[model samples]
Target: MDHPHLPGPAARHAPPEHPEGTAHAATLASFDRGLRREARPDGPGCRVERTGRVVRQTGPRHAWNGILWSGLDATNADAVIADQIRHYDALGLDFEWKAYGHDGPADLPARLLAAGFTAEDEETLMVAEAATLPRRIDLPAGVRLVPVTDAAGVRLVTEVHERAFGTDSAHIGRQLFDRLASAPDDVAAVLAMAGDEPVSAARLELYPGTDFAGLWGGGTVASWRGRGLYRALVAYRAGIAASRGHRYVQVDAADTSRPILLRLGFTPLTTTTPYVHAPATVR
Candidate 1:
């Protein structure tokens, strides 16, 4: 059996940008608002803000995400942040974060470490407002683009991803279909084809809660490489976000494709590194 790593073909992608209030940071701010999607019945659990924590019970099991500032003295900081962690613990979930480096909470890492928490992995946060993005992208020949919203379309996406990312992830197809079937308007998957065959794929998850829509799993087969299909797919996703009132789109990019994202008006806010912690005995 294989252990799960930093979301290889399935992990969510995040990028860091300034506080949403800034003009250059409008996109992230916009998506932040979009994230207030139809809330799940079991979310926004309790928080131990004094301890710097927020936990949601309805999402992934043992999962939580939050931020903190170390400016306060130890007692005050722990009082604030620890209360939040306690809330997450009450929910019986795991806590995690895809934090950026330059964030203001200077002593956040130490706080988390002292609280029995450990850094899972790091990933650079990236952002680009839709207004600042290029609307035009040239698709490589033989690659057909389509907005898929069904099971068959999702299967093709999973297959392309398996080939490109070197992992078997049929679960990815299920997740795509679930999201598409449940919230077609908020999220969309773009498929790039070579004569009816899906050769590349990617997903755009629009977070109306903040000004950030995320780009994830954009994978192209070796045969489909160098055709500009990937960039075209990204543009397609961005178009969807723009249409839905999202102003920014971000991606946690790998070295191979960082150049392409940089060309698309995306600013590298920070570098994100993924660290894995699978048991020595694979589960």
Candidate 2:
């Protein structure tokens, strides 16, 4: 299923005057290295490995299992992809091969499709300097933004996610909870609520040795849309990223959040699509 919170393809406003090429290179490099080194063992059942230029992440036994940061040449792309598929197949795991617009061997997408991988929606890779994001976003009259700490907070976040995206977020919530328990300072999960009811939620992942901090799962319930909650969440997460010394804040924006991110000074670096291979079913 398409993640409903994915930001759109169009930018509502003109992209700001930023060093587009430089920022894009830096963000992508940081992401490749940072994710390889920092985003591993995300929860109890998860693990990450580097094979050649591909970073293979498996388990949590959820939808996030995939191969990332692939930079293979034409000579080896097919073999490498086949190896990955066989490896995951042996484990009975469904996985995705993430393809970026700027990725090499430009025919990689075609190869994946030919190999029976189905493409998900392509999303813009939005990035910006943390210090450049707006900081003073105002919340609606009854809405309040708070950092998630306990199990209840985790539940609220998952609730908002399920309602906003129409998917079961229990796995995501469990991973977040595990991260918070093991490395509290490395991750931040925030929730927005009207009185005592949850309405919006987002997460910030701080990569200690990299220049980027990632924004994930930013979503608001249907009734809460257009109320500035999403922007507020962005600003709030950006503030945390800046304080943590990250120079850039990056998000894979879907159709819904793209415009909001663009207006807040994020540049569209490139587009990324995940080619998924589902586990074969028994007849």
Query: Candidate 1's error at 242, in angstroms?
Result: 1.7
Give candidate 1 misplaced runs (Cα > 4 Å).
1-52, 55-57, 60-95, 103-121, 271-283
lDDT of 2 by residue, 152-269 (tens): 8999999998998898889888888888888898899998989999999999988777888889988889998988988899999999999999999999898777877888898886
User: Model 2 off-target regions past 4 Å?
Assistant: 1-23, 36-39, 281-283
lDDT of 2 at 180: 87
Minimum summed lDDT over a 10-residue window in model 2 is located at: 6-15
The estimated TM-scores of all candidates read: 0.67, 0.88
Roughly what TM-score does model 2 have, to 2 decimal places? 0.88
Q: Which ten residues in a row are the worst by lDDT in model 1?
A: 35-44
Per-residue lDDT of model 1, residues 201-280, tens digit only:
89887765555677888888878788788778877888878877776787777666767777877776554432222222
| Model 1 C-alpha RMSD to native | 6.8
